[model samples]
Target: MTAAFVAGVGMTKFEKPGKREWDYPDMARESGTAALADAGLEYGQVEAAYVGYVYGDSTAGQRAVYELGLTGIPVVNVNNNCSTGSTALYLATQAVRSGQVDVALALGFEKMLPGALAAGYEDRESPLLRHLLALAELEEFAMPAAPYMFGAAGREHMRRFGSTPEQFARIAEKNHRHSAANPYAQFQDIYSLEQIQAAPMIYDPLTKLQCSPPSEGSAAAIVVSERFLDANGLRDRAVEIVGQSMVTDLASTFEAKSAITLVGADMSATAARQVYAQAGITPDQIDVIELHDCFSTNELLTYEALGLCEEGQGSTLVDADATTFGGQVVVNPSGGLISKGHPLGATGLAQCAELTWQLRGTAGDRQVQGATLALQHNIGLGGAAVVTAYRPAS
Candidate 1:
C-alpha cells in the first residue's frame, strides 16, 4: 500500500435546478478538465475514473468522461445517493493508495429537478424505505420525509439538550453569510436569524432556508500516489488524505428509536472516531471542516458526533462562535449543502474541492487562516457516513 494525495480539485458553480441548459456530461467535462488542468496533467494520465450521479442511467459515467477524453481507461459508475460524490472520491483514493493506479480521477455531478427531492421510482422498493420505516416507528409526520427526519432530530436535540430553534436558525444565518463569499454557492444572500426563523417552515424547527435545496452541479478531484507526485514534481501542490473512514447503519440506528440515531448520528460518530484515530489527531486539532448540512439540525447533531463538542452541548459551540470563521474551527466555510447547494452526487467532491483549496491557501475570501488541518464529513441515509482528514503534503 502507498499514500494517496489530492493533487488537484475543481468544481462548476452550483446553480438552481433548471437554471442551466447543460447535461451531466457537460458539467463533468467542465469540472474534470479543470481538475486535470489544475494538476498540470492530461486526462490520459488518469489510469482510472470513478464518476458518481444518482439521477442518471447506466454508463452515465462513461458518457461524462468521454467528454473529457477517450483514454480507454476503466471507469466505474457510483450511486450512493447523497453521499455518492464522496463515495466516488473514497474509491479513487483507495485505488491510488492500494497501488492499483498511480493516478485516478474522482468526478461527481447531478442535474436535478427544480424543487424538493422525491423518489425517482415509486413502483419499486426504495433504498431508504428501511430508514423511513425506522423513522415511522419512532414518530409520525405529515411533512416531507427528509425535513421531518432532520427536524425530528432537532426536536430530539432540543428535548435532550435544551437546544433552541433560535440556535438552529443561527446556524442557517451563519452558513448563508459564509456562502456570500463563495462563488459556487447556490444561495449567496445572507439572512438575519430572525428572517431565517420567520421563513416558511418546512418542518417544526426546519424552515425552508434551514434545509438544503435541490441543486445541480459537478465537482472533481485528481488523486495520485506519492510515487506519482514525486515523479511529476507535484508534491508541493498535493494535499495528503491522512485519514478516512466509512460506516453504515448500526443497531443503534433503530433500536434507540431516536431521530438523531436514525439520521446517521451514530454512523458519523463511529466513522469520525475511526478517522481521528487513523490520522492521530483530535477534533480540537482540526482547523477547518466541511461536514454535511443537508439540514441545519443535522449540522448541530454532527457537532457532537464528530466530537467537536460534547453530546447535548452542540448549542454551546454555536453560541460561542466555535464553528465559524475566526472561531475555534471553521466548519462549512463553503456554505455547506444548505447554501452551497446539495447536488447529491456532486456534494462530497465539492466538499473535497473546498477543503483542498483551503489547505492550499487558495480559498479566496472564505479562507480559514492557518488552516493546516481539515476534515470532511458526507453522509447519505440508507446509510453511509464517510469521514476524511486532510493536511498539507509533507
Candidate 2:
C-alpha cells in the first residue's frame, strides 16, 4: 500500500457558539490557507478535498473551498456527526494510500447553535431513536441525549468499579488545567476538582464544566502520498499515519442493556485494538492521546476502552495521575473536548492538527515532551468511532 503522511495542518481557535462574528466559510478559509502555507504548496497541488460539517447544506464543502481557490478539484462533502472531521481525514488518507490521489486536503468546520446537541431533523425518523429506545429500557431518558448517555455510563462505572464522582471531577479538572497552556482552547480558565464538581449540573454527575460546550471552529490538514512528499521535499516535516480504524455500533450496543455498551465503549475498544495491531504497538507505547471527551464520563469510559487501564478501573488511572503530564501517558494535552471545546464537525480534524503539532514538537507550552507516538479517538453516537495513530516520518 502507498504510505500517506500529513504534511501540514492548521486550525482556528475554537470559540463558543456565536462568540465570533465570522461564519464557517471564514473559519475554513483561515485554516485552509494556513495549512497550504505550512506545506509550502498552492491549492492547485491538492488533487482532491474532503470537507466535513454536521449542520450545513449539501455543498458547504464547495463554498468553503472556493475561498481558497477555484481549482475545480473534487470536493466531497462529509457528515458523520461528531466524528465527521476525523471521518473526512480517514477518507482523504485512504484516497492517498490507494494511489487514487497523490495529494488531498481534509478539512472540517462547524458553526453550531449555542447549547447541547439536539437532533437536527425531527420530522423525519431520528437516526438515534433506536439507541434512545435501548437506553429507555435500561434507564429513564434524560434530555440532551449526549450527557444522559455518557452520564449513565459513568454511573455504571461507579456501580461496577466503585468509581466516585469526585474522580470524574478530577478528569475535568485535569483537562481544564491542561487547557490553560493551550491558546486555542475555548475554556482555558483553570478549575479545581471542587469547582468542577460544584458547577451547575447538566446531567446526573456531569457538571456544566465537565461537558464540552457547543463550539464553532474549523481545522484543515494536507495529506500526501510518500511520493508526493519526496517530490515536494516535505519528508522532514511530515507526520506519518501509522494505523487507523473506524467502528460502528455492534449487536452488543442494544443487547447488553448496559450504559457503557449503549454509549459506544465496545466500538471504541474494537477500533483501538485494530489500530494497535496494525501499528504493532500497545496503549503503553502512546506518548500522547486525544480521545472523545464530549463529557468527562466518556473520557473515563474511554480510558478502559482504549486499553489505557483495565475495564472499570478508569478512576485508578485518574487517582494515580497516570493520564496527565509526567505520568503513564499524557492524555488530551490539547485540553480535549471538555476544555478545548467540541465543534462537532471540526473536532476530529482539530485532534489531527494537535497531534500533528505534538509529533513535530511545535505545540508550545502544551507540548508533550518527547511525544513520538500519538493516538486519536473520535466518535459520533448513532454511531461511529475512528481511532488513528501517528508518528513523525523517520
Candidate 3:
C-alpha cells in the first residue's frame, strides 16, 4: 500500500487542570482546529476521524467534533491504553493509505484528576478487578504511579541484568533536563542527578522524580493520502509515513518470563524490521526518536529493544550522553513521558507531533539538526507496542 503523509500536527501545553475549565472535548477541539489550520484545511476537509481516549466516556469523539462544527464524519473512538493516540493515528493512516479516505484526523485528549488511576478498566465488581486494583495500589506505592507496571518489570530487569537504580535515575535526569527546554512540557523544571536519586522513593530504586505526572492535554494530526496531497498542491511539504507496525504481548504477570526478554519482542522487532525495510533504512539511519518512556528503566530497555544500542548497554548510552539532544541519536527531545507528562491517549499523537516538528526543522530549541529520519514508539497495557517511521519530503 502507498504511504500516508502527515500534513499537519497540533498540541496544547501540557498542564494540570484547574478547578473548572475546558475539559477533554474542549482540549480535543482546540488541538483539532489548530491541526486543521496548520494543514490549511477546513473542518469539512476531514473525511474521517479517529479519537483516542483512556477514560473519556462514549461519544467523546462526537462531542469534540461537535465543538469543532464538524458533523457526519465517521468518528471512531479508540482505547489502546497508553498507545491509544498512536493506535488511533495508525487507523487513520491506514484509512488514507488504503484508498478508504483521502483526508483523516487522529486526535487524543485527556483530563486527569488527582488519584485517578486505572479508571479506564471496566467497573470493579469482579474479583479480578479487585485483585488488579490491589496490585495497582501496591505498585503505585512501590514505583511512580504512571509507570507502575514497569516497576515490576524494572525490578525484574535489575534481577536479570544487574541494572542499578542509579542508572534509571540518570535517565530521569536526562529527560528532566531536556524537558526544561520544552515550552509545551508540563514540567519544565530541571532536576540534577543527585536530586533525582535523592527524591522520595515511589518504588524501590524508582523515585517520585522519576515518574511522569498526570496532566491535561490534547494532540491532533492531519493525515492525507498522496493523491489528496497531489490534488491539493501539498505534496511538496508532506512528511511521508514510511512504516507503521503494532504488536501485542502476553498480559498476565505469571505468563511473563523476563522483563529484559520483552515477550512482544518478535512482534515489535518484526514491525520495526518491516518499517525499516519499507523505508529503505535501518535502525542506525534514524536520526531522532520518540519512544514511550513512562519510566526511566522503560527507556533503558527500549534502547536495546529498538536496537538503538546493544543489549544491557542502555546505561552506557545514557551515561555517555548518546541519547541526549544533539547526541549521536536524539531521543525524546520533547522531554519524553518522564518530563513532558503522559496524558495517556494524548501521548502517542504527541510523540508524532514532536517528530513532525523535528522533521520539518521547526522544533525550535529542542530541534535536532538535519533530522531527515525519525521514529515514534508507543506501548499499550499488556505489552502492545506500535512503531512508526517517517521521513521528510524528498
Candidate 4:
C-alpha cells in the first residue's frame, strides 16, 4: 500500500447540544469548507467520501456532503459507535493507500440531545448486549452504561493497582487546564483538583466533571496519496499517517473477568501494538497522543494499555506527571473528550485534527514543544478501537 497523508483537517467549535443554533448539515458545511480551504483544493477533487454519525437517518452522509458540493462522489456512511469518526478516517486512508482514489474525504458530525446518553432504539437488540452481560457478571450497574462500565474499570484499577479517586480527579484537572487554551473545546474553564473532586460523583471515582458531555460538533480530514501530494505541491502542509489499525474486542474482553478488559483496554492494547509494529517505533518514541477519555478513569487505564507504563502502574505515571505538556509525551493536549467534548462521531476526527496541528506546529498554546511523532487512539465499547500514528510529510 502507498502512504496516505492528511493534507488538511478542520473542525467546528464543540458545544453543548442546545447551545448551538446550527444543525449537522451546517456543521458539515463549515468544517468541509475549512478543510478544503486548508488543503487548497476544491470539493470536486475528492473522489470518494466517508461520512460518520451515530444519530441520523440513512443517507445523512449525502445530505451533509451535498452542502459542500454535488460532486456525485461515493459517500459511504459510517457508524462504529463512538469511534465512528476514526472509522471513517481509517476507510478514507485505506482508499488512498490502495490507489482506489487519489484523494478521499473523511467527515464526521453529531448533533446530540442534552442529558445522559440513552439507547436510541429500545425495540431492537442492543449492540452492547455482550458488553452489558459482561458488566452484569462483574457488578450491578451503578450509573448509565458509559459511566458504569468505565467506572467499574476504574474501581477495579483502584482495587488492584492501588490507584485512587484523587488520581482520576487529577486527570480531569489536567485536561480542563489544557482546554483553557483551546478555543474549540466545549468546556475550556480550568478546574482545580479539589474543585473536580467536589463535583457530584456519577460512579465512585468518576465525578460529573470527569464525564464527557453530550456534544454537538463536526470534523473533517482530507486524505491523499503520495502522488496527489507531489502533484499538488502539498508536502509542506501534509501530515503522513505513518501507521493505522482498527481492532475489535477479544475473548479476554469477557473471559478475563476484568472490568478494565471488559471496557476495551485489551482492544486498545492490541490496536496500539499493531500501530507501533507498523510504524516500527516504541511507545516511548511518541511525542504526543490523543486517546479516548470519555471518562478520566479510561485515561489512566489507557496509559498501561498503550505501553506507556506497565499494567497497574498508570497512577505512577499520573503521579510522575509524565503524560502532560512538560512531560515525556503530552497526552490530550487538545483537552480530550473530557473537556474538548465528545460528540460521538466527531471525537475521533477531532483527535486527528488536533494531532495534525501538533505535527505541523500549529496547535498554539496547547502545542507540545518539538513534537515530531504523534499517536491517536479512539475506541467504542460495542467494540472498535482505531489507532493511528503520524508524522509530518517528508
Q: What is the TM-score of each candidate against the true structure?
A: 0.99, 0.99, 0.91, 0.99
Which residue runs does candidate 1 get wrong by more than 4 Å? none
lDDT of 1 by residue, 1-394 (tens): 7999999998999999888899998899999999999999999899999999999899999999999999799999999878999999999999998899999999999999877778888799988788788787767865578898899889989998899999999999999999999999999999999899999999989999999999999999999999889999998889999999989889999888899999999999999999999899999999999999999999999999999988999999999988998798999999999999999999999999999999999999999989999999999999999999999995
**RMSD after Cα superposition, model 4:** 0.7
Alpha carbon lDDT at 158, candidate 4: 94
RMSD score of candidate 1 (Å) = 0.8
lDDT of 2 at 3: 92
Q: On a 0 to 100 scale, what is the lDDT of residue 31 in model 4?
A: 90
Q: Which portions of model 3 miss their true places by more than 4 Å?
A: 120-148, 250-256, 260-267
What's the C-alpha lDDT at position 129 in model 4?
83
Candidate 3 — which pairs collide?
A: 142-202, 142-203, 143-203
Candidate 2 per-residue lDDT, tens place, 103-190, comes to 9999999998987777777789888889888888877888988888889888888898999989999999999999999998999899
Score residue 22 of candidate 4 by CA lDDT.
98
Question: Over 4 Å off in model 2, which ranges?
Answer: none
Task: Tell me the tens digit of each residue's lDDT in model 3 across 99-184.
Answer: 99999999999888764365444655532343245455334333233455566667766776788898899889889888887998
How much lDDT does candidate 1 score? 0.93
Q: If ranked by lDDT, best first, what sequence of candidates would result? A: 4, 1, 2, 3
The CA lDDT of each predicted structure is 0.93, 0.93, 0.80, 0.94
